[model samples]
Target: MNVTGDDVRSLALSLPETTEQFAWGMPIFKVSGKLFLTLPEGETSMAVRCPILDRDELVLAEPAKFWIAAHEAGNAWVRVYLSALDDREELTAIVTDSWRQAAPRALLDSP
Candidate 1:
């Protein structure tokens, strides 16, 4: 029941200023030119940016739903398990937050 890369791409496209690109062979989503999330090629996880303090809490609460990429290991970002996200509300919150973090401050301050 793993969600495909297209599913991730579609979700990102629905966000404001989100555009897709390749970063380290992964599908990276950006908002106003800043990266927010990435689904690495041939991998089973997703790289999602989060407030530094929130990383441990999220992973501890749902280990199955979260992990950190080896490269980004121990960083603020966590790799969320796409298959574990069946709850639309929670997913929406995370995706929206990602967009907010990636979006420029001017855009956020604007309207």
Candidate 2:
């Protein structure tokens, strides 16, 4: 619900071993040095790690909520429209899932 880049940043940093770094002129969140999410230039949307298969299905299922930037095509990432999120729960789940994907196995094993 009206998720902003700050919402994204706070959530991402709340996860274990996550850090914020700037790359390609945007903010990127990484887990143990592995990139997990990115807040593009306008911060209207965020890109998160997603299996290519799942990304395609998501984009097709909810084009307004999810998409793959042309430059990001062929990569295992999907962009979520912050404005399109249904609620904070959805945002948390999405961000956490991306964190899980990039987090070290040791971190995943912990609570």
Candidate 3:
């Protein structure tokens, strides 16, 4: 299945404290000003916060679906191919995980 910008926007926005912002000619999803996801390359791909170690492993394990752009190489982030995503559930999991990483302690602990 293929995921689109709308899918990204909807899933990301459903998370707590999430908001959409346009930057660098693309859509970015943030949690209280801390960005968790960005849709670039015409929304065909997304960059999300991931642990540095997990980022490398994801890219290595599934190069077709995950990667690290050169500009973000020094950061703790990974890019995911929307087209490679299996379904909305998968996207939600990914977005939620990133959201957890960016969300504040209070938000995380909130019901």
Ranking of all candidate structures by their lDDT, best first: 2, 3, 1
Flag regions of model 1 displaced more than 4 Å: 41-43
> What is candidate 1's lDDT per residue for 11-55, written digit by digit as tens?
889987788887777778889888888887464567778976788
Q: Which residue segments of model 2 deviate by more than 4 Å?
A: none
Better model by TM-score: candidate 1 vs candidate 3: 3
- How many angstroms is residue 105 displaced in model 1 relative to the true structure, after the best TM-score fit? 1.6
Model 3: which ten-residue window has the lowest total lDDT? 86-95
Q: lDDT of candidate 1 vs native?
A: 0.77
Model 1 residue pairs with clashes: none
Most accurate candidate by lDDT: 2
What's the TM-score of every candidate structure?
Answer: 0.85, 0.97, 0.97
Ten contiguous residues minimizing lDDT sum, candidate 1: 39-48
Off by over 4 Å in 3: none
lDDT by residue for model 2 over 25-106, one digit each (tens)? 9999999999999999589999999999999999999999999999989899999999999999999999999999988999
